[model samples]
Target: MCTGKCSRFVGLALLPLAFIAIIVNLLLIFPNGETKWTNNITMQVWLMAGIGGAGLFMLCPSCNAIRAGGKGCCGEGCCGNRCRMLRSLISSIFGGLGSFYCVAVSGTALSNGPLCALTNQTGNAAQWGYHFKAMEDSYLFNKTSWDICVQPPNIVLWHIVLFSMLLGLGAIEFVLCAVQIINGLLGVMCGDCRKKENNNA
Candidate 1:
């Protein structure tokens, strides 16, 4: 396969995934579509895994790959296809790291659950904390258990859905980056296919 063409395809796919991750992560900060209890947001959300890891970190490398993939001089002698492929390899590594980080952080946030005010069984006292985390059974399975986090309406569901999205997106990004890493290595060793085609013609 043409190395530049493959890199360009991967870069194009990554762009939208990174954008979606950023938007989803931003949504986490504003629970229930409002930032009323911004202070009490979960640590994982504050980590900005979606924004920093999957968004900006992946964004830079993806853009670089896209630019490098465009039609251009593969360069002369030493600085030709090999050098470009080397750069693509390095960029793919960075993209892989960013996506892995997003997956880890998003998974953790989903497991620990959201921090919010909870009403006691007595209904007289309410306090802010991780309502689902303390329970042995995962709150995800128990629909009735969701009522404990009373302050942020449907926050349990919100965290579940959004964090899940981040996790899935990160995974897909990781796979694409991994593929590019292999492609880049091949390109570096054998040179881009376009040059071969031109020579044969």
Candidate 2:
């Protein structure tokens, strides 16, 4: 495939995934669509990995890839195809780093479980903490364990779905960026494939 076109396609693919990551991260702040417990949210939720790492970081790099692939004076004359490909390579690296960050944080949050009001024993009062941290098996597989959170109604299920989504999205974004890195390397090595073909003819 043409390196430029491939890079452009990868960039386009990352766009929606990044947007979804941002939305998913934001939703974590308001469990069960309620804001009462927002103050006591988990540290992962406050980290904004989706918005800052996956969303904005992916966005800037994707835009750069699009511009690098587009037909313009940027890749011609003094700039040269090699320089353009190098730029694309750098952008891909940045995108990969961002997606990796999202993946790491999402995985940690999934394993740690949600911060919610647990079933208090001594008195009927709300107590917030990482209730699932001590579990040997992940709460994701145990449907019965979903009842652990008392206040946010189905918060365990909520965290599972959202964090899983973010993890998957970040993974996909990372793969796409990795592909773009290879494409950029090819572009750099071969210069413009079309230009070479034209010269041969």
Candidate 3:
């Protein structure tokens, strides 16, 4: 049976480990505001799946303790329970974000092929002045089409949004875990003081 102090220490140690996992996941998903050259859709999907699995593994023990009506079973107090819950939630969210990013990037890549073909077929700019005029005319009715024609791939935007959400969630979990660890440590210290007082009495 672990003392409260021991449990608190374990919780404190695990907090950093959990944070590390989150950081690595973020790096894999969004390296330099987009997937790195090493990371493609398949790799990102696998990374996110791993993150979700790790989160669940870290959170399950604490959740079980909480369900058993025990506090600090995972080495912190109720704070440990909260951290575990947050981990699970963020993992699920990241999984969904990862899937969406994969689909969006793949779809955009495929669409660009057709777009390039069309532009090439139109030939020289001087000869395609009429085509450009038609494009401008269509731009009035659908601004999105015009923007898509001019803009490069936009996987970066999706990456930013997803990574921000992951960071925010991870921060919240870290704070809660830290607080719980402190509380558990304090409880152990107080218990020790009471024992000393009783001995003196």
Evaluated with lDDT, which candidate comes out highest?
1
Q: Report every candidate's CA lDDT.
A: 0.83, 0.82, 0.38
TM-score of each: 0.90, 0.90, 0.33
Cα misplacement distance, residue 103 of candidate 2 (Å): 0.4
lDDT of 2 at 160: 87
User: Once model 1 is optimally superposed onto the true structure by TM-score, how far is the C-alpha of residue 160 displaced, in angstroms?
Assistant: 0.6
Q: Report the Cα RMSD per candidate.
A: 2.1, 2.2, 13.6
> Mind giving the per-residue lDDT tens digits that candidate 2 earns over 8-90?
78878888888999999999999888888688777988888899788988997788677667653454533436676778799
Residue 6 lDDT, candidate 3, scale 0-100? 39
Give per-residue CA lDDT, model 1, range 1-201, as digits (tens): 688788788889889999999999999999889888677788999899899889988887687667657654446334446666777789889999999999999888888888878877788536888877888998877889887788777788888999999999999999999988998888778766766676789
How well does model 3 score by local distance difference test? 0.38
